[model samples]
Target chain A: MTPFELIVREHGPTVLRVCRAVLTAHDAKDAWSETFLSALQAYPRLGADANIEAWLVTIAKRKAIDVIRTRARTPVPVGDVPDGASELGIPDDERGEVWALIGALPDKQRKCVAYHYLVGLPHSEVAAIVGGTTDAARRAAADGVAALRRAYATIPGGTA
Target chain B: MTNIEAPNTADLDRLHDRLVHAADEAGLLDLAYRTVDTPIGRLLLAATDRGVVRVAFETEGHDRVLGDLAARVSPRILNTPKRLDTLARELDEYFAGQRLGFDVPIDFALSRGFRRDVLGHLAVIPYGTTESYAQVAVATGNPRAVRAVGTACATNPLPIVIPCHRVVRTDGSLGGYLGGLHVKRTLLDLEAAA
Candidate 1:
C-alpha cells in the first residue's frame, strides 16, 4: 500500500485548489484538511488502482457542500458590509474578487469549472463527480468560463 | 477558458499542519502518525485510538509497516502526529539523557501468541541492562523459545520504546536488532554512557 503521507504530499495542492474554487480561502483550507483526514482514514480501503484524483475531487465537492451548509447554519452578522465595487490588485484583492466571480456562477456550472478547470479533472470524471454526462459537463465548463470572461472583463484586472 | 492564475498557495503548507490540529479536535483522524528524525534515522510513528501502535525504522520499510497497520488495525489512519506528542517528547527526552523510562501507553494489537508474550517481557529489561535471548525465553516461561525470543526481538514493531535493543546473544555479545546491529550497538552504548 502507498504510504498515506505520500498521498498527502503529492495531491495536497490540487485538493486545496479544488476546495478554494468552491469555498472561501479559510473555509477551503478547513475543507481540504477534512478531506485529507477523511481520505487518510479511508485510504486503506481505497482500491489500489482507483483514480485518486477523481476520488479526491469527489471528497472535496462533498466537503465544499458542507462548508456552505455550515455558513447557512450560523446566524448572520448584522450589517455585514456588501462587497465594494473597486478595481483590485493582483495579490490580495484580485483573488477575492476572482473567487466572488466564480462563486457567483450557477451551481452546476460552478462545480464544472471548479472540478474541470481549476482542479483539472477530465470532462468524463468531472461529469461523474458533478452528476451528468461528459458532453454536459464540458458544455457547463465552457459556458462557465465564457460567463467568467464576460463578467470579468467588466471589472479591471478580472480577466488578468 | 479565461486564464486564472493559480493563487499563491504558500499558505496551504502552514494550513496543512494547522488543519491536523483541527481534524484531531473534530474527532476525524482515527490513526495519527508522523515521521520523526532520531539518532538512528527517520522513524515512522503511528498510533491508534488506544495508544502508540507502531514505531518503525527506515530500513524496515515505512510503507510496509503502515500497510501492516492498515490491515491489522483500523484502516482509518492519518499522519496527524498530535496524538503522539507525548511519545515524541518522551523519545526526545530519552535521547537527550533526561528520561530513564518511557511513560507512554503502547498498543500491541498487531502482535500475538509467543511474539506478544516475548515483547511484554522485553519492556521491563531496564534502561542500561542487557539480557540474553535465552534468559528472556526462560523468563517468558518457554525455555525452548530461545530462537523464538530472537525472532520476536527481530520483528519488534515498537523497538526503542519496548527496549528490544537490550536483548543480546547468550555469549554476552549483541545478537541482532530489527533496527540493525549498528543501531542496536548505538542504543546499548547510549545507555552505557548515561
Candidate 2:
C-alpha cells in the first residue's frame, strides 16, 4: 500500500467517528465526502511533519461546524430516542449499536465524546476546538461515556 | 475498564479500533472499484475492504478521486484502490437488480443538526418505493418542516446508500438530487423493474 493510503486506513475511522459525532449519519456522509474531497486537493502540500490524522480531523470538524452553521436556521427536533426494538429488521453491528447510543447523547456531550475519545484529542485540544476550557471538554466527554455505558448496559453483556 | 478518568492513549486506540470494527463487524467487507456504464455516464465506484464507499457519476480524473480517498480513508489512502473492488461488485449488483440493499459502512461525521435529521430519516426509505418530503417530515415527527426535508435530501452525500433518491415531492414529481435527477430516475426505475 502507498504511504498515503496506509495512513488513511489507520486514521480514517477516527475522522469518520469525529464527523459522525458532530453530524448525523446522513449529513456525516456529505461532510465526510466534502472533507475528503478537500483533503485530496490539499494532500500534496501537507507537510510530512504534520499529524495527518489530526489535520484531517481538524478539517472534518470545521466542515461539520459549517454544516451546523448553514443549517442552524432550522431547529428540527431530534425525534424520540430510538429503541432497539424499532430497528429489529436492520442488521446489528457495533457501528449501528454504538451509533444508536451515540445518537441518544445531547449534542455537546456527543461532540465531546467524538473529539476526545474517538478522535484522541486531549481535553485541552478538544477544549480549544470547541471553544471551552479543558475541564469542560473533559466533563462532557465523561458524561457522554457514562450515558453511553448506561444506555448499552440494558443490552445484556454490552459492557459494564 | 472502570476508573476511566481520562481517555489515555490506549483508550483512544481501543475506541478507534472498535469504531473501525463497527463497520467490519457489520459485514461490509468488499473493496473494489469498477467503471460502470450507466445511463447517466461512467460512474466512479469505490468500496472498502467490505462494501462500496463512493459511486460518483460523470466524475472523472485521478487527482480528485485520489484526494477523495485521502479524506475518507485519510492517512490510509493506499487501501482505497482495493476498496474500489468492493464498490465495483456492489454497483454491479445494484444495477443488475440482484441487490436489494447495500451493506456498506458509511462515515456520517460531517453532518450534524438539521441536515443530519433529514438524512437519517431518508435512510429508512425502503428500496423501489418513494416518499414525499412532507411525509418524511411527518414521519420524522417534524410535520411542519417539509422544506427542511427537501434541503436534507439535497445535501445527502451517500445518496444511494441513504436512498435519498426515494424522497420525492408531494405531487409525485422528482424534486432535486445532488447526484442529479437522471440518476434518481435510473435508481427508481431499477427498483421498479424488480
Candidate 3:
C-alpha cells in the first residue's frame, strides 16, 4: 500500500474542491477532515488496484451529506446566512463569484456538476454518489453549466 | 466555467493544517513525520504519539522507510511536522555541538528482543567516545552475542539520537554504518572535534 501521506498530497486539493462545491467553506473543511480521517482508518485494507480518487470522492460526498444533515438540525437566525463569496472568506475575487453561481445551483445539479466537471468523475460515478441514472447525472451537470453560462454572460465586463 | 480553478495554494495549505489538527484530535494520525536538513544529510524524522520512533537518512530511501513504517506500524500516517518539532530542535542542538544528549521521549516499538536491549545500552556509550561490539555485547549481558550487538547497532531505528555511531569494531575500525561509512566517519569526526 502507498503511504497515506502520498494519498493526502495527491488527492487533497480535489477533495477540498468537491467539498467546497457541495457545502459551505466552514462546513467544507469539516467534511474534508472527516472524509480523510475515515479514509485513513480504512486505507490499509484498500486493494492495490482500487480507484483512490473515486474512493475518496465517494467518502467526501457522504461526509458532505452528514454536514448538511447536521446543519438542518441547527437553528439559524433569519437573514443571517452570508452569500457564498463572503462566507467562503474570499469576497473580492472572481472565483468567489463563480462559487456563488455554483452554490446557487439546485442540489442535484450542483453535486453532479462538482463530481463531473470540477473533479472529472464520469456521470455514472456522479450518479453512484448523488443517486440517479447516468443519463440523469449527465443532464443535471449540463443544465447546471448552462445556467452558469447564462449568469456569467450577464455579469458586467465578464469574460467567458 | 474557466474561472473554476483549483483552490489556491494558501487555501490548500490551510485545509491541510485543519486536516492534520482534526486527525490529531481524532487520534487518527498514528505516525507523523518531517524531514530535517542535517550536517550529514536530510534526515527523515517520524514519531508516534508515544514519542520519536524512526530517524532515517536520505540514503536509506525515505519513501522505502515510510512504506516500511506503514506496514510495520500503522498506515494512518501524515506529514504533520508539529509532532516532531521538539525532536527536530534537539537534533539541531546536537549537531551544533550545544547538546550532548537527547531528552526527548522515544518509542522503541520498532526494535525487539535483544536488539531493543542492545539499543538501550547504546545511550550510555557517551559523547566523544567509542565502544567495541564486544563491549556493547558485554554491557547488554550477552558477551558472546557480539554479532547480535553489531546487528543491533546496524539496524538502530533511531540512529544519532541513540548514539549507534559510537560503536566500532573490536579492532578499533569502523565496522559499518547504515547511513554509509562516510557518514559514520563524519559523525565520529564531528563529535571528536566538539
Candidate 4:
C-alpha cells in the first residue's frame, strides 16, 4: 500500500475545496480534519483499485453533515446573519466571489456542482452520495452553473 | 465554474497544518516524518508518539521506507515536522562535531529479539572507537552470535542514533552498513576526527 502521507498530500486541496463548497470555511476546516482522520484510521483496509478521491469526498460529505447537524442544535442569537451571506470571511477577490455564488446555490445544486465540477466525480458517483438519480445530479449541476452565469453577468466588470 | 481555481497553495497549506494539529490532538496520527539535509546526505526521520522510530538515508529510498512503515506500523502517517525538531537539532550538532551522543528517546519497535538486543548494545560503543562483530556479540551476552550481531547492524532501523557504524569485522574491515560503505567510512572518520 502507498503511504498515507502521499494520500493526504495528493488529495488534501481537492478535499478542502469540496468541504468549502458544502459548508462554511470555518466548518470546512473541521470537516477536512475529521475526514482525513477517519480516512487514516481506515486506510489500510482500502482496496488497491479504490477511487481515492471519491472515497474521500464521500467521507467529507458525511463529516460536513455532522458539522451542519451540530450547528443546527446550537441556538443562533437573534439578528445573527445566517451563513453563506456576505460575512463568510472570504476576501473580496474573484475566487471569493465565485465561492460565495456557489455557496448561495440550493443545497442539492451546490453539492452536485461541488462533486461533479469541483471534485471531478461522475454524475453517477454524485448521485450515489446525494441520494438521487444520475440524470437528476447532472441536471442540478447544469442548472446550477447556468444560474451562476446569469447572476455573474449582472455584476459590473464580472467576467464569467 | 470553468474559471474557478482550486484553493490557493497558501490556503491549502494552512488547512493542512490545522488538520495535522487536530489529528495529533485526537490521537489519530500514528506516525509523523520529515526529511533533513545533513553533511552525509538528506535523511528521512520518522517517529511515533512513543519516540523516534526510523531514520533512513537517501540511498535507502525514502519512499520505500515510508511504504515499509505503513505496512509494518500504521498507515496513519503524515509529513508533520514539528515532532522531530529536537532530533534534527541534535543531528546538526553531531554532524558539526559539537555533540558526541544523542539523547532523544528511541522507539525500537522495528527491531526485535536478538537484533534489538544488539542495537541496544551498539549505543554502548563509545564514539571514535570501533568494535568487531565478535566483540559486540560478546557484549550482548552471546559470543557465538557474531553473525547475528552483523545482521543486527546491517538492519539497524535508527542507524547513526544507535551508533551501528561503530561495529566492524574482526579483521578490522568495515563489514557493511545500511547506509552505503562510503557513508559508514564517513561517519567513522567524522567521529575519529572529532
Candidate 5:
C-alpha cells in the first residue's frame, strides 16, 4: 500500500471526527473530502518524518474553517417549516412539537450542541475547532443544552 | 415557559441515534452501519452496495458518513446496512479471536497503485506478526524504497482492517496510528491476547 493510503486508512476516523466537531454535519462531510484531497496533493512536499495524524488534522481544521467562513458570507435558506412546531418531517404530530423546540436554537448553539454531544469531542478539541478557548467551548455547550431543556419544558410532553 | 433552547448532550445523543435510525429507515443515506461500542468511543463500520466504502469513528453522525459515501462513490452509492452485518459479526469475532481474517469484499477505489501495493502487502502481515517499513520495501521489490513503504503505511485509508498497525519501524518500535496509539496498542494486545 502507498504510505499515504495507509495514513488515510489509519487516520480517516480522526479526520472525520475533527471535521464533524468543527463544521456542521452538512458541511463536515465536504470538509472531510477536501481534507484528503488536499493532503494527497500536498504529500510530496511534507517532510518524511512529519506526524501524519497531525498533518491530517491540520488539513481538516483548515478546510472546516474555510467552510465556516464561506457560509458566514451568505446564509443558506433552511428548508421550509410546515407549522410553528412541525417542519422537520416528523411522522407524528406530537413528536414534531418536541423537535421544534430543539430546532429553535440559534445556529451557533445548535452547532455547539451537535459537536459536543453527537461528535463527542472533548472541550479542548471543540474549542480548537470553534476558534475559542476550552472554557468558552464548554460554556457554550452547557448553555446550549440548558436552553434546550427549558425549551422542551414549554411543550406538553417535554421534560428537561 | 418563557424561554426555549437547544438540545442537551443527553438529548442530542438520543436524537443522534434516532436520526441515524430514521436515516436507515428512510434510505436517506447510501451507507448504513453500526458503531461498535469498543475501547474506543464507537467504531463505525459503513459500506455501500459496491463494497465497504468507509469505516469511521462514531463521532460524526449520518450526515458525515453519507457525505463521505457520496463523494467517494458519487453515483454508485447504495446504502446496504445488511451487507455490513456480516462484517460486524466478523469484526466482533476477530476481536474475540474466533476469526482469523476478513472474507468480505472491499472496494479499494479509495486507493491506487503504490498505496494499494503497500496496504495489500500490509494485509498479509499475519495477525500475530509484525513487519518493518524497510522489510515491506524489500517485499515490494525495491529495497531502497523503505521511505516509500513508510509513506504507504502513513497514507493507508483503512487502518485495522488493512492491518497497517502490524507495520513497525525497522528498529522494532511501534509506529503511528491515525486512531491514536491507545487504539493501536489495544489491537496489538488483542492479537497478543489471542
Candidate 6:
C-alpha cells in the first residue's frame, strides 16, 4: 500500500481545485482537509484496484456539499468578510479569481468541469459522482467551460 | 490547458502542514511516519501519540512495515514528518557522530513478553560497546535465554534506536541483525569510529 503522504502530495492540488471549483477558496480549504482526513480514516479499506483520484474527488464533492450546508445555516459577521483573501497570505491566487468564476456555474455543471477539466478524469467517472449519464456530464462540462470562457474574458488578465 | 496550475506549489506545502495539524488535533492521525536516508540505508521512522514507535531499515521494506503497523496500531497512518522531525535530526546527528544517545521516547508495543524485556536491556548497552547475546540474556536475568535474545535481536522493531545491533556472539563474532550483517557492522563501526 502507498503511504498517505504520497497521496496528498501527488493529488493535493488537484483535490484543492476540485474543492475550489465546488466551493470558494476559503471554504475549499475546509473541504480539502475533510476530504483527506476522511480518506485517511478509510484508507485501509480502500481497494488495491481503486482509482485514487476519482475516489478523492467523490469525497471532496460530498464534503463540499457539507460545507455548503453549514455555511447556509451559520450567520456571518459583516466585519469578518473574506473579500480580502489575498491579504491573509493565501498566495499567488490569481487562480482564486478563476475558481470564483468556475464556482459561479450551476452546481452540477461546475463539478463536472472541475472533475473533467481540472482533474482530467473521464466523463464516466465524473458521472459516477455527479449522478448522471456520461453524455450529460460531458455536456455540462462543455457548457461550464464555455461559460468560464465568457466570464474569464471579463477578468483583468484572463487568457480568453 | 495541459498544465493546470490551480493550487500553487507553495500553498500545497502549506496545506500539507495544515492537514497534519488538523488531523492531529482531531485525533484521527495514529501513525505519523517519514523516511530518512542514512549511512547504512534509508530508514523508515514512525511515531505514535506515546512516542517513536518504529525505526525500520530499508531492507525491512518500508511499505510492509506500514502495513504491519496499520494492522497492529490504528490504520490511520500519514507521512507527517513533523512528528519525527526531532528524531530524524537526532539520527542525522548520531550518524555524523555529534550525538551519543537518542533523546526520543520509543514505544515497544510491537514486541512483547521476553522480546520486550530483551530490548529494554539492549537499550542500555551503551554506544561503542558490544555485548554477546549470552551476556545480554544474563543481564536481563535469563542467562539460559540466549536463543531468545537472538530471536529478540532478529525481530526487534526499533533496531538502531533500541541498539539491537550491539548484541554479538559470545566468541566476539557479529551475530545476525534485522538490518542484515553489513548494516549491523556499519552501525557498530559508526559508534566505534565515533
DockQ each: 0.36, 0.10, 0.61, 0.59, 0.03, 0.40
Native contact share for candidate 5: 0.00
**What are the root-mean-square deviations of the candidates from the true structure over C-alphas?**
4.4, 21.5, 3.0, 3.2, 14.2, 4.4
**Can you write out model 1's per-residue Cα lDDT over A60-89, one digit (the tens) per residue?**
878878877889864122112255532121
How much lDDT does candidate 2 score?
Answer: 0.65
List pairs with backbone clashes in candidate 1: A41-B76
**Model 2 regions lying over 4 Å from their true place:** A1-45, A48-160, B1-39, B46-53, B59-76
In model 6, how large is the Cα lDDT of residue A78? 20
lDDT of 5 at B141: 80
Model 3 Cα displacement at B121 (Å)? 1.9
Instruction: List TM-scores for all candidates, in order.
Output: 0.80, 0.43, 0.90, 0.90, 0.46, 0.80
State the TM-score for model 5. 0.46
Count of clashes, each model: 1, 37, 0, 0, 31, 0
Q: Write the per-residue lDDT of candidate 4 for residues B1-194, one digit (tens) a residue.
A: 68776666777788778778878998888899999999889999999999999999999999999999989998888888999999999999999999999998899999999999999889889989999999999999999998899889988999999999999998999999989999999999999999
Candidate 3: CAPRI quality band: medium
Put down candidate 1 lDDT per residue, B87-109, tens digits, no spaces.
88888988887888999888998
Q: State the lDDT of candidate 5 residue by residue for B22-131, as single tens digits.
A: 44455444444555665565776766546665666554454465455545654222333455788877878888787778888776777788878888888798987888
Q: Is candidate 2 or candidate 6 better by DockQ?
A: 6
Best by DockQ: 3
**Residue-level lDDT tens digits of model 6 in A1-160:** 6667768878898898887766655777888988998898788788989999989988998898898888886411122225665322245654555655665677788778888998999999889889979999999999988888887788687777
By TM-score, who's the top model here?
4
B1-194 per-residue lDDT for model 2 (tens digits): 13222213443344434433432344332233445565566766655553445555554453466566556554333333334555456767888899878766765654578878887777777888999999999988899998988888876656677788999999999998877778789889999998
TM-score of 6: 0.80
Candidate 3: tens digits of C-alpha lDDT, residues A29-129: 78888898899888978998999999999999889888888889641112234654366524444577677678878888888998999899999988988
| B-chain TM-score for every candidate | 0.90, 0.67, 0.96, 0.97, 0.74, 0.92
lDDT per residue as tens, model 3, B1-194: 86776767777788778878888998888999999999999999999999999999999999999999999999888998999999899889988988889998999999999999999999888899999999999899999999999889999999999999999998999999999999999989889998
Write down the worst ten-residue block by lDDT for model 3 chain A.
A74-83
CA shift of B69, model 3, Å: 0.7
Model 4: what TM-score? 0.90
Candidate 4 residues A17-86, lDDT tens each?
Answer: 8988877777787888889888987887899899999999999999998988888964111123355564
Question: lDDT by residue for model 2 over A1-160, one digit each (tens)?
Answer: 1235445456666666676656665566566656755665566568868877678888898888888788797322243535644331123333455665666688778778877887777888888778788999999999989888887777766765
